[model samples]
Target: MASMFRAASVAFFCILSIAVADAQPIKPSASTQGFHSRARLIGGGQQGEHWLAGIEITLDQGFKTYWRTPGDSGLPPRFDWSGSENVASTEIRWPAPKRHEDAAGVAYVYGKQAVIPVLVKPKDPTKPIRLVLALEYGVCKDICIPANADLTLDLSGADSERKAIEAALAKVPLLQKLGAQADLSILSIAPVAGDKPAFTVTIQAPPGTKPALFPEGPENWFFSASHPAEGDRFTVTIEEKPKDVSGPVPLHLTLVAGDKAVETEVSLDENGKPR
Candidate 1:
């Protein structure tokens, strides 16, 4: 009996060691130590000026993180590069996020790991970019805690890591072209005129399959979560629009229908035709 008990204890130690190795923290300036994350510089375009980048995050077992729009709950990951030099603009291109559920509600998150593709535009293309990033994101299982990282990657030597960036870039979602007829394409986004002014987005998807629609926009506007109507169309009711708005409103939509998904950012004229 004593020998059997010792065997079990050894097995437990081995399992714990494996989990710890898998969830090792990323080497960074400051972090909560729950997960590991860092910024990576991909190579420049082939004979072009633009460069690619990514944020690689690895979470421990049973832990999760949020997307830009964490439906109903959770804090979205935030990145700030104001301290960096020779950088004019930076855009984060998110891959399709996974949906997670808890007692509080649903959350769109990255389970276990995620790589967020980034587009970096520099003030001078000829010179190297000294990119710096300060990232803050939530890590949750039952209780959520904030995790922070300070990462710096010199772009001069990014050529060595070309393949890694290429792999992540492949996951970035491409924009849906106008007048696409494929079943995965979002056919139309029309205004629903009634008691509550809403935008009815119709996706050309499979019948009876409920599609998941995620809306991305400024912080002030609220685009209520949508559901699949009868047939191939889905309706996204606009709960609120910006007040005293004058410029054109561009709505970005990501539609997930089964294994197939697509995204588009387009502006609609008052008449609802694609603009």
Candidate 2:
């Protein structure tokens, strides 16, 4: 009877050991070297029903990278995950970006380091996932250099990089409805009549905070950064309006102030009124 009890105890200990091993943090994949930069894939364990991951780019001092909407004269990062397995869908989240004005033009960029958070939904959550990413982006100092990287990782356990991923996630702008009433929100949008059609935006922000606006419109449409016209009022002019496209234009606007940020979408007609 004592021998039987010992055998059962040993079996229970083995199962516990396996569970602990599975929960251990996974190491980041090998980095792909680039000019004054390096890129790699990092697992961030699981968050609720979906798995979290990050594409970490470490840049040398004085080097920077572009955001999803590279304001004026930069290349945005492009990601391809056709080589991945067990991924049903993947969503890349962009953190609030900073505005930089140089000879090239006003651009939105990240300096020093950038970690882009990715939320991946697995086709089968019970099975292990193999994440493979093909990334193409640009790093700029004085001149811009295009870079590419191929990174892969088998994600079945937690990762030590989870904390870093969460930090990036915190910077991602929260989604809010257009004209939402909040301490930091877009109060109103109106049409500005000029040589070129423009929109005037009024935002509500905390006192002593300087706010900036980033606007994204339909394909082939480019807009200038919101220029402050007066107190709490800014104007965004249409730079390049797509040819042969008429009717209402949809705008995705991101507003950032100090440590608060939010994103909202609205559509306007030729008259600049909400459509």
- Separate clash counts for every candidate: 1, 0
lDDT against true structure, model 2: 0.87
Q: After superposing candidate 2 on the true structure, give the runs of residues whose Cα lies further than 4 Å from its correct spot.
A: 1-29, 270-274
Question: Model 1: runs farther than 4 Å from truth?
Answer: 1-47, 122-127, 158-161, 177-179, 191-195, 206-210, 240-248, 258-260, 266-275
In candidate 2 the C-alpha lDDT for residue 269 amounts to: 75
Q: What is each predicted model's overall lDDT from 0 to 1?
A: 0.68, 0.87
Residue 184 shift from truth in candidate 1, angstroms:
1.5
TM-score of each: 0.69, 0.86
Write the residue-wise lDDT of candidate 1 on 1-275 in tens digits. 99999999999999999999989965543222434433233443422455676676778788888888876678788999886678888888777776566697667788776777667788988787766787888888887778877776666644654566666556555689645888777777676665655666777776655577787655566655545665555565555656655445677888776655678887744333335
Residue 143 lDDT, candidate 1, scale 0-100 = 71
lDDT of 1 at 268: 46
